[model samples]
Target: MIMPRGSDQLLLPVNPFFIALTLLLAFAFMLLPFGRHPALPDLLAVVLVFWTVHQPRRVGVGLGFCFGLLLDVHQGALLGQHALAYSLLAYAAISAHRRLLWFGVVEQALQIAPLFFAAHLVSLLVGLAAGGMFPGWWMFLAPVIEALAWPLVTIALLAPQRRAPDPDENRPL
Candidate 1:
């Protein structure tokens, strides 16, 4: 659990480079052959949601659209399917950002579950409209997994932003 820092605390600012790197890593993780399972958490989507909620200016609809396009191309799926889904998720995150900030990471996950689920539904619907076959019921489970993993993602990503304890404050020498 990430302890909330006081408003007076001075923590390190988030670097755009690290955000991009983590997103890239998430994409690479998605490419790993997981034995054709559809229930795997979409790590990229999780990261997207994380940034969109926490840093709207850095990770907005434009970035989401671009990332979705890349994923579509990489996965050989219908173009605009993921684009629409990701953009929708970004929009939802931006809309809910303020509210999410008031909650803890675990509670935030519960609220975020619907966004992930809705994003998947948008993708599925777009694919269907494009004459693609249904991806099966397991696809729905992806959001749940992603939502459940939200707290972990939050903790990992926020580690760099957390203020370290001052070493000299505890010294008795």
Candidate 2:
């Protein structure tokens, strides 16, 4: 099959342990005392979406739900707020996974911007419906920051997969 122009090369099979480690690391990042800044990007969401898109079969809605619940418990927010948002985010990423892979990292970032925005929107709406105070205009910045983070996260996460498994002078794959 002819590969898409945007897909530069084949990737090594993803390691399951690496995926779990990244997810756990993102979760740990969320647990940091960031003072609840409204514009703070959701590193967990960004990482979740990346894995959902890249490894749909391995990382899907269920994982998103579980992590979202954990985040909810951590933040003491409405029970299913992040769960609903993340599940939807994962679903959207999985739905667009095939087409999303055909774009360069930057373009892929732009494409997923709406998904991140929508997830934030869902979270905001849920919070509002629960009578939570508005987090102010800064709330909108999170999704943009998350979108901006896409390329960096993509590059970092894909680094391990980019290395040649069996390097040889004559093999330039």
Candidate 1 Cα misplacement greater than 4 A, ranges: 1-10, 165-167, 170-173
Which parts of model 2 are misplaced by more than 4 Å?
Answer: 1-7
Which candidate wins on TM-score?
A: 2
In model 1, which range of ten residues has the least summed lDDT? Answer: 1-10
Task: Count the clashes in each prediction.
Answer: 0, 0
lDDT of 1 by residue, 57-164 (tens): 899999999989998998888988888999999999999999998898889999999999999888888888889888689988999999999999998998888756
Q: In angstroms, how far off is 19's CA in candidate 2?
A: 0.1
Query: How does each model score on lDDT?
Result: 0.87, 0.95
Clashing pairs in 2: none
Question: Per-residue CA lDDT of candidate 2, range 12-122, in tens?
Answer: 999999999999999999999989889999999999999999999999999999999999999999999999999999999999999999888899989999999999999
